[model samples]
Each structure stands twice: as C-alpha cells, then as structure tokens.
Target: MRRVTVQYFDGCPNWKVLDERLRDLAGEHDLAIDHRRVETPEEAERVGFRGSPTLLIDDVDPFATGDEPVGLACRVYLTDDGPQGSPTVEQLRAVLA
Candidate 1:
C-alpha cells in the first residue's frame, strides 16, 4: 500500500478538505493516510513542511514547486479548477493511482 502523509498545522482549515478527499480516495487506491500536525516553525523546518495541507506521497510532495515559504500557512493548489485551498479529488486520485 502507498503511504500518504498529510502534514498540516491546526490553524489552516484547508487540511480538512484534503483529509476528506484522501478518505474518499482511500478505498479506490491501495493506500494509507497518516496525519501529522505540525506545531512549531522549528518542526516545520525540520520536516521540510512547505505549508498546511501539504500532501507527502511516500515522503515527497508531488505538488510542491520547491519555492514555497515554510511555516504555518494556507497552501494553495493550482488545479485545472484554478487555485484552490486543496487539490481536487481527481488530482489526488491520479497521484494515488
């Protein structure tokens, strides 16, 4: 099963959206979701956290552009639907698949 780590901070409501999408896609794909709540800037830097709702597939953020500022902040995804708080279910499904 693919291990997906959802790294987020409590301040951002966007993470919940990603969580829901992941839960929806879980059954369709062979994967497990691990939620990590980051509580500090030091911890964020330590773990390479780009922003809240960062989806780390096998310990890597496939959506990251490598230029996002670290710390507790809302991450926006540039989907075909345009920029959004979280990636669409279809986007998540493609990565999981």
Candidate 2:
C-alpha cells in the first residue's frame, strides 16, 4: 500500500482539488490518504511543507523539485494542460501507479 499525505493550510482551496483526485484514485492504487493541516510557520518549517496542497508520498514529495521554499502559500503544478491548481487525474495515476 502507498501512503499519501496531503499537507495544506486552510486558506488555500487547491487542496480540495487534489483531495478529489486522490479519492478517485485511492481504491485502485491501494493508497492510504492522510490529511495534515499545517497551521503555523513553525509547524510548516518543521514538516518541510513546501506549500499548501503539497503531496507527500511515502514521506517523499515526488512532485517537488527541491527548489520550492517552505511556506504557507498556494502551490501550482506544471501540468501537461498547463499550470494548474492541482495535478490532473492522469498525472496522479502516473504517480500512484
């Protein structure tokens, strides 16, 4: 089974977008989804949270380039469809596969 942790602050709506995609993929992918709310700057730093809606798969962020600074902010993903608030279903499948 794969563990997927979604870390986000309340202000960002993008997390919900990812949440739906994860839900759609969870059954087939054997994913155990965990939602974490990073409430403060210190907590964000402690958790190495790059931004809201950051997906940590097996404790590693597969989507990260190691260039994003830790913070409480909305994250944008560069998708085949162009920049998006969340990754597409196809993209999520590729990762979860």
Candidate 3:
C-alpha cells in the first residue's frame, strides 16, 4: 500500500477540500490516507511543511517546488487557468499517477 500524508494548518479552509479530493483519489488507487495537522510554526519546520494542504507521497512532497516559503499560511497552486487554493483533480491525478 502507498503511504500518503497531508500536512496542514488549522487556519486554512482549503485543507478539508484537499483532504476530500485526496480521499477520492486514494480510493481509486487503493491507497490509504493519513492526515497530519501541524499546529505550530515549530512543528511545521520540524516536518518541513511548506504550507497548508501539502500532500506527501511516501514521506516526500511530490508537488513541492523546494522554493516555497516555510511557514503557516495558505498555499497557492498554479493551474492552467490560474492560481488556485487547492490543486485541481487533474493535477492531483497526474501527480498520483
């Protein structure tokens, strides 16, 4: 089974949406979803959390650009249309695939 972790801060509203989308994707892939809530900046730094709704596949953030500022804040994903709070389903599917 593939291990997936979604690290997020409580302040971000998009976390739940990301979680739900990931759950759907996991269901299709027969993967288990692990949700981790990072409540502090220290914890975020300890876990290398980039921002809210960070998806980690096998302990690696596949979508991370490595240049994102590490802190407690909302994350923006660049999509074909524009910047989105949460990545589109197609983006998620492509990453998971």
Best by lDDT: 2
lDDT tens digits, residue span 1-97, model 3: 7878888888998888888898888777777889899999998888888898888889988878888988898888898989888888899888788
Sliding window of 10 residues with minimal summed lDDT for model 3: 22-31
lDDT (Cα) of model 3: 0.86
Model 3 segments beyond 4 Å from truth?
Answer: none
Pull out the clashing pairs in model 1: none
Higher-lDDT candidate of 1 and 3 = 1
Name model 2 segments beyond 4 Å from true: none
Rank order (by lDDT, best first): 2, 1, 3
RMSD of each: 0.9, 0.8, 1.0
Write model 2 residue lDDT over 1-97, tens digit each, in one string.
8899999999999999999999989989988999999999999889899998999898988899989899898999999889998888998988887
**Candidate 1 lDDT, 1-97, residue by residue in tens:** 8899999999999999999999988888877899999999999999888898999998889898888998878889999979999999988877777
Better of 2 and 3 by lDDT: 2
Evaluate residue 20 in candidate 3 and report its C-alpha lDDT on the 0 to 100 scale: 85
Cα error, candidate 1, residue 30 (Å): 1.9
Q: How do the predictions measure up, each by TM-score? A: 0.94, 0.95, 0.93
What Cα-based lDDT does every candidate model obtain? 0.90, 0.91, 0.86
**Candidate 2, pairs of clashing residues:** none
